[model samples]
Target chain A: MAEFDKNMDFPELDAYFSKTSEAADDRMALLELLKRGAVAYRGTEELRKKCLNARELLPKEYRYLEFAGLQKLIEKCKIFDLKNYSRELIKCIIIGVCYYTLFQSIAASAVIFILCLIVMVGGGYMTHRKNAKKLETYYNLAVELRGVFPELELEEDYCSEEKLMSLYDIVQANELTSLESAVVKLKAIG
Target chain B: MGKEIQWLSFKTREQKQADLDEYTRWVFKYGQPQKEKVEQILSRLFPKEAPSMAMMTYLLGRDAYYGRYNTKKSSDRNPIKDMYDVLSKKRYQVPKKDIPLYMALIIADERVSEALDYPPDDVLHVVAARLMEQE
Candidate 1:
């Protein structure tokens, strides 16, 4: 069995396959696609046929499981990528060190804590602002629809008991929050 | 060789519709009143524009999952159980301290609902429980 190299890029894989394995890049690409869930295994006769046909196009030794092994490597690289974890760990350590240093000086610690709090609050506020904009967009779209369909009387006649009940049903079924339920209610009313 | 991958069958159109219908009925029974309360909160939060109800519903659902539902752990040290410790102490009056958490929960719920395609009513119950639990 070939040892899987985590550090190897696509080009490296291609080179290795071309030199050692008999399978061409096309077979590799198909396997890669399937591994990514871009193509479904079942009910995909065309793809299955393509893979089968392509197998003959390649060397017999560099067939089925070899192709599957490469696909699994591709998936493993995607799933267990340590970059995000490494970055987060580094950030936590840096923050911990900074806090420790700040604690050495009580005045500095207070300032640092306040600064961190401000940053967190500001970030939260910014997020809320973004949500507000989304709400505005939805509101504007509703208003525009009302303007276009004035005869329908969207705001007034839009929310029938049946519609409200139905919307309520959707909220309950999904087990949504009060705010979520309200939003559905408003949509039904509109 | 590893275990063979088994592809689950997709739901039939009729089955999907029936599920949707059942879900909708449950939501109506449980979700409507909670929605009213959320609307009141939203109106207070954003006095300028009439807040989008759809967005609110979506947010509420998301928060219910992320904040409350997702926190459920099999271990004894469950953070969800001690939710009241972090919630507002004031029983009747909505304390200024608690409002932020409430608002945050609402926003979180919306995102979860949108991502999961959850029904609004289920989200509402979760939100109500989180809110009332604080009291």
Candidate 2:
């Protein structure tokens, strides 16, 4: 058992030591038992309380720590989910345009046979070809819009909200047929 | 020759329109809110207003094109290089942290591939990489 003081910084510790001192004449025996049981229990309880406090301090959105969890949900129902599908389709189109531009450059080199051979060896050729054509078609349509509305420069920063909204409105207005419907569906979800 | 001219009947235009309407309404009710929350988080991190709708559409369209296909190698032309050149000429600067959000948002719309006037993925990747370097 240890000495206890009322004004001790650790009042709980003082109280514990005092109780152990009263339990036995042999200070060492009483101190040993209290050290193993009471001290350990208090320490564990304090740790648990601290952990809860830390968790409470986090933002409400981050409290759940559900970024990956939500992503999994989105991936699970992507196709039927209009927003997910729209978003994915847009990504696909962007990739397609990159591929098309690259292909056009390669085609200009007049090494058509070499390009064909390279594509044959590449596992993604089929998907790449499909996306390229689709992006080309979309680009053509967008150029036509540029002709109609000269002020809306299609070649400016691609991520501007104004540009996105204008394109969304264009798509919503059925300017590009099936593609327009798809854009509208994406906006609805986004 | 006469058999080839037959118009196939599936769902009527009215039924298709109704389906589209219901789908759009549901998306707006649930998906839009979540997307907005994500965008808010991005704005706080980047301290910039979200990109304009037209810009987003074009970007998304570009992303769609790249995401779906692989670029062909050319002797004098690199698709990624071209993207960097185009982006460098743009007036607005796209910070790095916000690139993922932009990609995610554009990809969120399936029609992005059809909406863009140019390749978006290469430019997005270049910009994102540049932004990451600063971080």
* Predicted complexes: DockQ each: 0.01, 0.01
Q: Which candidate is the best by lDDT?
A: 1
CA deviation > 4 Å runs, candidate 1 = A1-190, B1-9, B21-34, B47-135
Q: Taking the tens digit of each residue's C-alpha lDDT, what string does model 2 give over B16-51?
A: 689667744533344555445434433443454644
Candidate 2, which CAPRI tier? incorrect
List model 1 lDDT by residue over B1-135, tens digit each. 012233553777897689667654443333655556456555554455446843343343433323433444535332322332323234423444434344344433333321232223434445444444444
Each candidate: what lDDT? 0.41, 0.39
Q: RMSD to the native, candidate 2?
A: 42.8
Residue A113 displacement (Å), model 2: 99
Cα error, candidate 2, residue B9 (Å):
26
> What would the per-residue lDDT of candidate 1 be over residues A1-190, giving only the tens digit for each residue?
1222222223322333344333223334433432332212223334334444444443344333332254443344334333524544454455645886857765665566556544554454554454444434433343443343233232312223333344445444544434244355656656
Write down the worst ten-residue block by lDDT for model 1 chain A: A1-10
